[model samples]
Target: MRRRPQKPRPTGASQYRINHQIRIPQIRVIGPEGDQLGIMSPDEARDIAVEAGLDLVEVAPTAKPPVCRIMDYGKFRYEQSKKVSSARSARVEIKTLRMRPKTDTHDMETITRKARSFLEKGDKVRFVMRLRGREQAHISLWITKLNAMVETLNDIATVIQTPRIEGRMITATIEPNNSSSQSSSSSSSSAPSTTTSSSSS
Candidate 1:
């Protein structure tokens, strides 16, 4: 018998596990403000949502006991739909930097500079390192290199998709770190600038 083709991973609005779709007996819950509300029965979580006049949504299904949050389902769906639509019209730029395994430090420096530029522009960066011959033998070493390179950009960027070995290529993606930028602005505004002066009697 031929193996049945796997169903395409669910995408878009239908992927959301909200309210009755969350069947787990117990799950971790979070309040609307992103605070942990601890673990509770699904029914209990639903009651909390009901009291709060919101919807209980399973945000992280794969986590231990899963994680559900009290949110406005209608708003969530609207935002999700808008994300798909806006993302298309956003004209987001993605630049892929191709390299070979065991890339030299000089080459890495160049790649880092390019990645930083793309991220600073609010563009995405995809790192693809092709392996040839025996270079593919030590995949771990290449992954370590990719991870290190990602860390160097962490202050300005955040990983959307972690590096992975796909056949002969290691691939990863990163986008501008908006939260970092916001935090930096806040920090600058709060910086101490007032100087104390002493007077002699």
Candidate 2:
């Protein structure tokens, strides 16, 4: 009995068609230095890339004739990975702080400081006040406290979501104050440090 031939396994590099893998007869080619080499046959492009000691890679397959670039494929892939990593690191995160209606002044200050730090770092802050037992009967009082807490950070933050009671909890979201941020940044850059110069007699 004859055995069946196995299919080629998919690979990470399969997303990009390189060199001889590009079956299209013609494509728009970009040189290693990013200069357009005009439309040319895949074989011709492959030859130029070989002369340059690089790979002809298909970057935009959706174009009419497709777009191919001649470059060090390994370096190109590494740069793409770096861009992805940078985007992930630059993403803003939302931080949540929990409290209660009876939280003392010290704890409130701590929470406010933490929220302020988060806002400074360009992250959103979510305030959650959980009501327990008979505390649920007085949501209005809790909302008052929540608003007061928000007011303390008004210089650096703005209320994005007003306090709303959800079941046994009151939630509010706050983000960095754009106006204050701009003013602060401008002032810091414009302000000069004061220093006393000693007179030599």
Candidate 3:
């Protein structure tokens, strides 16, 4: 079924002060381009913001010297809007790979390759190793395979979940090591797709 589109997020032109109300102490104000305006009282800070045709936004209320920025509330909000949108667009979805207990060595290798591909794309990999019949008695085998698979991916991914036997299946999850690793992984995943597309074209 087609889902209804979510409501658009409020941008710069929309309300900048959502439900937040802040009472700042001494403020070290900064100009629009980040030039310092020294320290001032709250009223003086507001006056400065008013004169500059901007908002007295408390940027570093927790700093030793509270910091405020004189900015167009709407424009500041717009940039934040763009950041959120960019982040959402850049997000990679998690992918799952499942296998039966009797899967062949070659098949396991293929599944490992696919999982590595998924991890390289910055997607979390859910490895579900299913056990059937008396095969459940050999849960140790599945754990061993899971550990080996995770070890193989140590350079690209880290195990997020340890092997846990759940009913008829043992499952684990793996994620990228860090932000740089994530980027590398995504680019690696995209290379194959780009190649396939170029060949098709």
Candidate 4:
């Protein structure tokens, strides 16, 4: 009699061991809802995962006997990717928007729009109001103008550094309001049904 060929195991995302890829003799299993299911063989655990229509993922491989969880592997990987992308976008980098004291209304609007874009992406923004020659005499006025310029982003950011004159420059820094953004990101991800019912006109 001829022996049947063995199926190949999954071969991507080495950061995790999933399904038949888990070759450990014994492992600790966690249920779909995170309840501990005690020690079991990988084959037994894989059986449960298959019945539940989920993947057995080795989450804590360093732990004694190792720990595995039954979950939707595709969803888990997608959320992890989203978190990484969010982290990179939210990394605090100071972006400077420079304008002279004599910078006009139209130019100021353009600057504020650019600043708003930076703040939305969770970056720190520094507004620089440069003063030279006689423009230095109106430092107070320029500082007020700078403050007003940043007020446009009041809903999305907090002023970290108030506008202050430093030699020939007036500068202020504002950072994104993380609490609001994080709350939105953490909210339930279930998208609403978009199917519409037809009605008689």
User: Mind giving the per-residue lDDT tens digits that candidate 3 earns over 97-154?
Assistant: 7777667778778888887787676667777877778988888987897788778888
Task: Report how far off residue 99 is in candidate 3 (Å).
Answer: 0.6
Highest-scoring model, lDDT: 2
Once model 1 is optimally superposed onto the true structure by TM-score, how far is the C-alpha of residue 172 displaced, in angstroms?
A: 0.5
Better of 2 and 3 by TM-score: 2
User: Deviation in angstroms for 19 in model 4?
Assistant: 0.3
lDDT of 4 by residue, 1-201 (tens): 222212334546557888787898999999999999999999998888878878889899999999999887877878988988876654445677888877888888888888888778666788877777998888888888888988988988888799987878888988778734553443344221221111110
- Kindly give the stretch of ten consecutive residues in candidate 2 with the minimal lDDT sum: 192-201
The regions of model 3 sitting more than 4 angstroms off are 1-85, 89-92, 179-201
Model 3 residue-pair collision total = 1
Q: Distance from true position, residue 194, model 4, in Å? A: 40
Clash pairs (backbone) in predicted model 3: 120-185
* Model 2: colliding residue pairs: none
Model 4 CA lDDT for position 175: 73
Off by over 4 Å in 2: 1-30, 33-86, 179-201
Q: Which stretches of candidate 1 lie over 4 Å from their true place?
A: 1-89, 179-201
Q: Per-prediction TM-score, please?
A: 0.45, 0.52, 0.48, 0.57
Q: What is candidate 2's lDDT per residue for 90-174, written digit by digit as tens? A: 4545678888889888888888888898789766688888889999988898899999999999999888799999888898988
